[model samples]
Target: MHDAGDAVSLLRDGVVLLGFGLVFVLLFRRLGLGATLGYLVAGAVVGPHVLGLVGDAESKIGVAELGITLLLFIVGLELNPSRLWRMKQEIFGLGLLQVVLCGIAISAVVLFATHSSVAAALALGLPLALSSTAQVLPMLQSAGRMRTPFGERAFSILLFQDLSIVPLITIVAVMSRNPADANGPPGWLLFIYTVLAVGGLIVAGRFILRPLFRIIGNMGEREMFVFAGLFTVIASAAIMEALGLSTALGAFVAGVMLADSPYRHELEADVEPFRSILLGLFFLAIGMMLDLHAIAERPLFVAGMALALIATKALIIFGIGMAFRMPWRGALALGLLLSQGGEFGFVLFAQAQNALLIKPEAASLFGAIITLSMATTPFLMTITRRIRAQPVDSSDREGPVADGANALIVGYGRFGQTVAQMLIAQGIPVTLIDTDIEMIDVASGFGAKVYYGDGTRLDLLRQAGAAEAELIMFCTDGDQLSAELIDGVHESFPKAAIFVRAFDRRSLLKLKDAHVDGVVREVMESAVKMARLAMKSIGIDDSEINRSEEHYRARDKERLKAQYETGDLRAARDRIITQDARPDTGLGGGGK
Candidate 1:
């Protein structure tokens, strides 16, 4: 009876917490502030310091920290050996420099300013060197630059940063001030454990995890994958916990082991929801745990520290990017994009507090500074848009040549495959571009080379030789194109005739003002063909079928024109004909 009562209480508490989270998250998202901030705000409002609607923040955080574990797992899944090797130069070279330099620089600043011990400065500053991957990746994706060179470079740094968390944890553990940590394994022994553990995970991934997933997949029981995914993460974390190691590291190892598996995406999809919810919960708990009074007492300290952190990291990163031969604008953009403190700072702050290297009040003050730094990113990018938008000097580099490819197809999906094949069937020189990593791998297996990048960007288009190509086909799905973009392409490459694949009427209407050579509705022709088949099965004569299709084609064209003119899909609804022109058209006009 007590257990049942406790369950009911838990449910009610969940409802209230989620209700607060949803409201604030939606509000913040609408205002262009990220969901992380929203969760923090909600948690603070409902916390003991404010409305006191919730309590036991420390207990809540212990559970919510699983979100961090799950997040690490997903990050590991992204680092497949092949992808890692492909971006090795950027990931290792530039990424290593960014983390090391920024970490050292920030540590020195913390050491000198706060007069903290070397260990304490490292615990605080190393984490600050990392940027918010969660915030930055979505921004890149939304801008359709996720596969661009600049975006990829940014991602490389972020990936290394995520990878750095493990060693950072080890460092924190090494500097533990708690007597409780004294009984733990020594540093060298811990390194051995790390190696043996990683090897075991890889072996498990190849034998145990893969076979289990395959069996579940073959059974077509998708729900089981979710169960299995959670089991894998929890089991790995449990293994580490039993060994008195970092549980998050265990989950990360599990993820990396499965990164190259066929079921990577499925596992990610299954586990993403739980990760998101728990992560939100984690932030909420952090918010509740935040020492508002500490921040209030040291407002000047908070503001000054935030500014110093952002400026120091940005300047350091900008120099590294330039040293790596990035264009000035690209380097500047990279700096600004990654200038903010990340969520992991909070995680490390807790670690520092636990290690007894930093007081809880110091952690809270730094946490507030990190949060403030995060809030400034969106505004900073908005202000520096023009400076980063400047064209790179062509004389500093050799220009991209089309290599005599007459047609450049922007997408290499099903639609693109057909178009490219038809063009190739006619013996036309062709180049294919795409953003889907899995699709690119599959296409490569079939001996088709698909260059990976967002095809919608004018800069990427130019880099792909859009200026020299005779035809540029945008066969990408959905409404990713715009008149302004089309005009830019046209203005840049006068010789290239542009053709676009419109997903629907709305997309077509949106592109109505663009001076493109052609626009093909993706499903219109196939839908018309199927409709004709239906008419033919019902015994309509060839002439009647032709007339019906022609009528629909004509009416649709007229309706589309009207709708496009008025900028409304509902403008020409009356033009749809319910009654046919054929009088008493009988089935087969007399049974064949």
Candidate 2:
């Protein structure tokens, strides 16, 4: 371990990996290609097969495995039981269908070509069935589609795939077990043991985990808390390995158990850096493992196999989407998004090779094909976006909202829709204006009164009768656009009362400066409501909770106004703190 040559090699590998990774990531991003592809290219260039800068890709396997575990752990942290239940249809219905159908179809092809045993065919095909969650989710998020219908469907399918890995690992382990060893446990016994191990994990998570976290949290040492979180993940994984189950399953369960904890956010922040770096290393390892020699020998065969895999997956996914009644455009986009083989394929294939489920030669060829397919995903997604793009219709000039509406709503997005719905239910007439023509079209289809026009444009505002409206509400997502609208309306139509939706404290303060009649911080009220629930959970009385909330809200409002007026944030904060500390103050008690 202390050898100088070993240290030198390690240093050299690190240097080449990080150096090439940085350059490739920046370059690929500028060229509109994704980072995962960049990592692969970087690894390929500096690998032993190419430049010999980094020796023995196998040496990094253990580190790469940890990256996969951490990635699943983070995924589990983002999901809770309730959220899982909400998407049960997509997860169980569409997700299960996709895996089964794709696996069967691919396995049939593999069997026909190689005449392999069913188990071996399945071992190869199942991995191919899974799509890249790591790549697809981030791409959707960056494109502002994470909350769209297509994005939600893609996420549900991905979540199911992630969960499906546990069972796949168990199957591989079972298949790998030697039948000749009579001393080894029987199949039935092994199955019972697996069930027992899972039950034990559930019990431990429910009874033991929360209290342990509570004790750690009370210490007030952030580093200690971080250590505890890491320890929980690693130790859980170790226990699962000891019990002959997958480490990933254990990590996922532990993450879900802590998902509802107050410390969830802190734990996420603590583990994110480790997860990112390790995940990068995992991708790098895959790149280094690329068999350039195999590719060079049969480039045509490899290219054809890659294309077939993509086309097969894309066609199956598109068919599934159509069956589920998704719009053709959305279905096509989803197909392209999920056509690539997942990062999990590498892990599964390696495990299969070790288990003798497939020959090493076949595994190498398949691995190369998977890597090539992954590299094509970003480009395919760009094409899918083009196909899904909608043209704006500007021919409709009729006022969908009543011509004499009392309220003018800027931006008919999610927030604006909710506000408009509540007002409409109460018989309040509202005229909506938004820059997104697609959103306007969708809203109009739902019988909403929406106009396709930019709120920041004074000409459009006048056309929408903003001057005659009793109140102009700014519910647009963009702070700059909302600010511009606020200033324009205040200057041009002084009689119109202005209300705004602000994303954060800065936006709130800026809106106050613009002299809006009302400003609602996006999450402030919801946060207070959550705080009330927390207080109630801790046995605080209902009346006490209400009184405390009211007093705190009033004081906070006064303090915010003072902070804005005097422009002395520190002094204002200090005064509020001092006042709240006084026993005579109503805020210091449940009630006067």
Clashes of each: 0, 0
Per-residue error for 182 in candidate 1, Å, reads 0.9
> Model 2, 1-592: lDDT tens per residue?
5699888878888988999999998897777566777787888888867887886778786777787787777777877768888888998988998888887787776677668898898888888889887778878888887876677899989988988887887777677733432345766887887678667777787788778878878888888887988887888788878765678888887788778777778888888888888888877887887778877888887787778888988999999999999878778888888998887888788778767788766777778888789889888877666577654545554433338888888878888988888988999888888777556666778887677766777777777787788888889895664456578788987878988888777676666557678888887888899989999998888988888787777778788878788766553664353444543455334233
Using TM-score as the measure, the top candidate is 1
| Cα lDDT tens digits for candidate 1, 1-592 | 9999988877876787899999999998887668888898889888887888888888889999999999999998998899999999999998899999999999998898899999999999999998988788887888777877888999999999999998888789889988888788887988888888878888988989999999999999999999999999999999888777888899999999899999999999999999999999999999888889889999999999999998998898899888989888889989988999998888998998999999998888888888899889888889999888754344532233456789999889899999999999999988888877557666879898777677788888888888889999999988989999999999998999999999988899889999899999999999999999998898878988887777778888889989988998898787776544333324234221
Model 1 TM-score, all chains together: 0.76
Per-prediction TM-score, please?
A: 0.76, 0.75
After aligning candidate 1 to the native by TM-score, how far in Å is the CA of 399 from where it should be?
A: 15
Which residue runs does candidate 1 get wrong by more than 4 Å?
1-9, 391-504, 507-519, 522-568, 571-592
Scored by lDDT, model 1 comes in at 0.88
At residue 140, candidate 1 shows an lDDT of 86
Error of 1 at 55 (Å): 1.1
Q: After TM-score superposition, what is the CA distance of residue 250 in candidate 2 from its true location, in Å?
A: 2.9
lDDT (Cα, 0-100) at 590 in candidate 1: 24
